[model samples]
Target chain A: MVDVVGSASSLHYAITGRPNCSLSAAGTCCVFLSIATITLIVAFGFFLAGAWVVLPFAGAELGALFWSLRYVCLHAGDYERLTIDHDKVLVEHHTTKQDVRFELNGYWARVILDCQPNGYCRRLALRSHGKEIEFGRFLSSEERLNVGRLLKSRLGGYLS
Target chain B: MATTIPIQDVHNEHHADNHPDHHPTGWMRWVMSTNHKDIGTLYLWFSFGMFLFAGALAMLIRAELFQPGLQFFQPNVFNQLTTMHGLIMIFGAIMPAFVGFANWQIPLMIGAPDMAFPRLNNWSFWLLPMAGLLLIGAFFVPGGAMAGGWTMYPPLFIQGGPSYDMTIFAIHIMGISSIMGSINIITTILNMRAPGMTLMKMPMFVWTWLITAFLLISAMPVLASAVTMLLMDRHFGTSFFNAAGGGDPVMYQHIFWFFGHPEVYIMILPAFGILSTIIPTFSRKPLFGYRSMVYATVVLASLAFIVWAHHMFTVGMPIASQLFFMYATMLIAVPTGVKVFNWTATMWKGSISFETPMLFAIAVVCLFTIGGFSGLVLAIVPVDIQLQDTYYVVAHFHYVLFSGAAMSIMGGIYYWLPKWTGHMYDERLGKIHFWLTAIAFNVTFFPMHFLGLAGMPRRIPDYALQFANFNMIVSLGAFVLGASQLLFLYTVIKCIRSGAVAGNRPWEGAETLEWTLPSPPPYHSFETAPVIK
Candidate 1:
C-alpha cells in the first residue's frame, strides 16, 4: 500500500502511501450501481409477494456493501508523502477534504517506530522541537517500519 | 504456545522463506490461532467430518431402503434420517467446505498477508462446529431430530417435539455464522488485493466466491427470518406460519423457498468458480471467455431470486404465476449454459490433461448440466406436479449438489493439498479415489430418476413391489459411494503426513500468486505486496 520512491542512496527520499482498494472510484461506483439495482428489484419483488421482511434485510445488506465500497472510494484519494534531505524533513498528508504539511530541521528530527507485541509497527512518526507529527497512516506495518528506517538513516537520534 | 515473534526476527520477502518455522504448537495453537492457513484447515476438516457424518446418515437411510418393509427404524425415525441428512449435508458439509476454500486461497491468490479480519475469520470458522454440533446433538434429545422434512412445512412442523426448537436454534446459529463469514470474505476481496490486481484480473475462483458471498449475505437473513417466525409460531404464539391463527400455510412455503432457492446457488456457484480455476490450469490455456464467465455468474446469481416459486408449482399457484416462474426458471439455463459452454470451449482442442482435479471439474461440468436439465424437467409446472416429492427431485439436487458442489470441493482439495502440505499426494491413489467417487456417485443417484418417474415418492421407508428393484440398486450404489470417501480421507492424510517434496509451483500451469511462493507458503507472505500487472 506504500510506494517508496527513494532508498538509502538517494539524496532525497520520497515515500508515498495510499489506502488499498480493489477498484478505482469509477469502478467502485459501477459495482455499487449493479448491486444496488439488483438489490432494489429483488427486495421490491419480494415485497410485492407479501414477504415484506426481506426488504429490511436487503436494504441493510445493501447499505453495508455500499458503506464498505464508499469507504474505499472515499479514501482512494488520500495519501501520505514524506521528503527527507540532508538538513530538513517534509511531511505532507492529504485526505478527501484536508491537506496538511509540516517542515522540520532534519538534524533534530527522530523516527519513532512503535511496534506492537506482534512486531508490527502500529505507528510511525517524526518528532522535533518537542512536537511529533505522524504519517504513513495508510501504509502496512512493514512499510511503516521501512519508512521509519529510511528517515532514521537521514536524521540521527534526536536530543531527549 | 506461539513463539514470541519480535521485530528483529521479521524479514523482508527475500528472507521470509528462509525462516519458515513460525508455526505454533500445542492444543491452544488450534484453539486460538489467528492464522488464515490454520483457520482454512480447520474449516476443511470440519466440513469433511460433517460430510462423513451426513453420508453415514444417508447410508442408514439407504440401509433401511435396501429391502422392502420396515428393515430399520419406524417411519418417524426414517423421517429424521432423511431430514437430518439433507440439512447436515447442505449446511454442515457443502457451505462450510466452500468457505474453507475461500479462506485458504483468497488471500494467497490475491497477494495479501492474510484475511482482512483474521480474528473475525476465526470466529466465523469456530462458530460452524458449534452450530453443526447443536444440530447433530438433537438426535440424542428425547424426541429425536426434527423430522418435518428439511423444508419443515407447517402443520407437520407444528407438532414436532423439543428437537424442532433445537433445530430452529441451531439454524439461527448457523445463519449468524454464515452471515459473518460472508461479510469477512466480501471485505477481504474488495479491499485486500495487491496494488495492481484489478477486479478484472482476479482469478475466477475469487470472482465466483465473491458472487457466492453476496448471495449468502442476501439469502441467509431471509432464512433467519423464516426460521424465527417458525419458532414464534411454535412457542411465542405468533401466527407468522400457524394456520390456526389465520395464517396461510402456503405462506411458509413461499418464505422458505425464497431462501431455499438461493441456498442451492450458494452451494453451487463456488463449484463453478472451482471448475473455472482448474480447467484452465490443466488446459494450459487462458480461460476462454473470462468476461462472459463473470457475467454468467452474476446473471445466474441474480436470476436465483426470481425463480423460487418454481419449487411451488404443485402448491396451487395462479396459472399466470406458474407460467412466470416456469419461464424465469428456464431463463437461468442461458447463463448456466454459458458457463457450461465456456468450460467446454476452454477445453476444446487444447493440450488438456486429466489431473484428479481436472477429472472432477470435467465430470462436474457434464453431470451438473445433466442435473440442470433435470431441473428444467422439474421446472415444467405439470411435470413438477407429479415429481414434486419423488426420488427424481432428490436425484436432481444430488447431481447438482453432490456432483456439482461436493465433487468440486473434493477436486479443489486434491488441487491444493500439495501446496498446503508441502508434499505431493499419492497421485495414483488420488486418481483411484476420484474414479471411485465419480463412478459410484452416478451409480447411487442416477437411478433415482427412473424410480421417481415410476412414481415412487421420496422420504418413504417402504415402497411397492414395482419400486423395489430400483431402490435396491440405489442402496447398493449408495453404499459404494459412501465407502469411497474413505479413500479420499486416506489420500489427504497421507499427503499431509508425508510424501515427496513438492517444490513451489507443483503445477507448471498454475499462474496464481499462491504458486509463486514456497510449496507451503511462509506464515507471513508477500511481505512487500507483489504488484500484479
Candidate 2:
C-alpha cells in the first residue's frame, strides 16, 4: 500500500492512503458525555454555593454546547479515498453513517484541475466516458492541486 | 481535459461533508444548526426585535419627559424604563447585531468553510434569547425589575427586590455567551485564514472584529467579576460594595468603569469596521492608510483601558490621578482623529457613489464625530463635573450609540442585504427612511444639548419649566423617529419577500471573497477553501 498522511502541523484533517484512519479512535459520544458531565458538575458546585439561579442557565448552555459537539463528532470520521490498480481506479467516500464506492475503467479515466484566471485552484474533478466525479472538496486549494497532480501521474499510462 | 481512463459509477451512500442535502429543514434546523449563516440570521432578527422593544421603552421615557412632572409613570417605574432601555440597547441590540455581522461575514471573508467552532457559535446565539427571557421576565416579578440603573451600582442595587437576582442571573448568562462568542471569533481568525491571507491582508471588518473580540474576552470577565461581587453582597452577606459592612461603593465604580470603558469601544469598534468596509467600497478605491488604520484601532483599544477613570471624574480622586485620566482620555482623540482622516482621505479624489449604505456611512462619520467632540469636552475634569449626569451626557451617548452604532448597523444591513437575501432593497424607501431618521433623530437629541447646558439633570421624572419647550420638541421628534423605523421594517420585509434579484457583486466596487460567491450563497459556502492572493 502506498500511504500518504497529512502532517499534524497543518489543518487538523488527517488523510491516510491506507484504509485505516489516523483520527482519534476514541468514541465521539463518550467525548461529549465527558464534557457535559464536567460542565454540569462545575455548575452544580456553584448552585451549592448559593448561586442557585446558575443551575438552569448552566444546563441550557451546556446542553447547547453538547449538541454542537455532537455535530462535530458525527462528521469527524468523514474522508474520501482513491485507489488505483492495473485495470481500475476506485473512489470511496466514508462518513460516520455510511460508505460509498465508485469504480471506473483505468484506460478512460481523466483528471482535471479547473483553476481561476489568477492561477488559484478551484476544484478537482475526474471525468470518463460521459461520467464525472469530483472529490477533495474539504482540502485547501493548494492541497487540491497537489492531489490533482498525484492522481494524474498515477493514471498516466492509459492516455491515447 | 486529460484522458487517462474511463469511469461510469455513482454512489450516494456517503455524501461530502458540506453537502446541503442533509441540512435539517424547519424549526429543528434553527435549534440544532451548526451552520454560521443560519445562526447569523437568528442573531440579526432577534437583535432587531430587541431594538424595537428597547426603543418602545425609550419612546415612553420621552413621553413621560414631554411635559415634565410625572405624566405616564411613577418615579420607580420610570427608573425601570430607563434602566431596561439602556441595558436592552447596549447588551441586547448593539452587541448582538455586530455579532450577527461577524457570524455572516467572517467565514465567507476568510475562505473558511465554517467557524472554528460551529457548535459553539450556535450555543452562543441561543443563549441570548434565554438571557433576554430572564431579563424580560423580571418585569412580572415583585418590585418589577431592578431599577438601580443598568450600571447596577451597589447599596441601592443590594436593596432591590427579587428582580435584582433575576437581572444578575441574566447578566451572568449574557456575559458567558459573549465570552464564548469572542473565543470563537479569535480562534477562527487566528487559525482559519485561507493560504496567503495574512493578518494584514484580512478585511478591515475582520481586523476590527479581531480586536473587538479581544476586548470582549478581557472586559467581559471584569464585568462578570463585578456583578458576581454585587451578587455576593446582595445574597451572601459579603460587603464588596456595602460601606456599612466595611466595603467601599467606589471600588465597584472602579471595576465597573474598567469594564464599562472598554465596553464602549466594544460597541463602536465594529461600527468603525462597518464604516471602514462601506466607505472604501463606495469610494471605489483602496482604503487610505491601511496599516495606519490597523495601528490606530489598536491604539484606541489600548487607550480605552487607561481612560476608565474619566467616566468617574466627579467621584473625587487625587489631582494626580485626575490629571492622568484627563490627559489619557484626551489622548484617545489622536488615534480617533487618525481614523477619521483616513476615511476622508479614502473618499477624496475617488469615484464615490451615494448608495443607501454609503449615505448611512457618511452620516455615521459626521454624527459620530460630533459625539466624539462632545466626549472630548466631557473628558476635561472641570467640564465633566458640570456636565456629568446632565442631559448633555445623555445627548453625547445618544449621538454616539444611536447615530453612530445603530446607523452603521443600518448601513451594514443595506450593504449586505443583497448578498444575504439575493434581492435589492428599494432604494427610494431606503433614502426616505434615512432622511426621516436623520431629521427626527436630530430634533429629538439636538435640543438635549441645550437642555444639558441649561442645567437639566437626567434620569428624573420631573424638571423645571425652563426645559419644557425642548422636552416637548424632543418628545415630538422621538415619536416621529420611532414611527419612521416602520419604513425600515417595511423596506427590509419587502426586499426579502419580493424584489429584483441581485446578481453576484451587487455593488460595483465590492472586493471581498464574499462577493465572489453566489448572490444567495449556498447553505454550505466555500466548501473548498479559497486561496487568497
lDDT of each candidate versus the true structure: 0.84, 0.82
lDDT of 2 by residue, B1-533 (tens): 22232244343223334244347888999999999999899999999999999999999999999996889899999999999999999999999999999999999998877787888899999999998988888889989987988999888998999989888888888898897897677667755677668889989999999889877755665677678888889889988678998878887888788789999999999999999999999999999999999999999988987899898988899999999999999999999999999999999998998999999999999999999999999999999999999999999999999999999999999999999999999999999999899889899998999999999998898899999999999999999999988889999999999799999999999999999998888787776557777
Q: What is the C-alpha lDDT profile of model 1 across B208-318, one tens digit per residue? A: 999998888778767876777777788878776666788778988888988899999999999998898899899988899999999999999989998999888888988
Pairs in clash, predicted candidate 1:
none
The DockQ figures for the candidates are 0.18, 0.12
TM-scores, all models, native as reference: 0.87, 0.82
Cα lDDT tens digits, model 1, A1-160, are 6676667768877888876666667777776777677667766776776666667767777776677677667777888888777676777777777776677777777887777566766567776655667777677767777677777767867221
Model 2 local distance difference test score: 0.82
Highest-TM-score candidate: 1
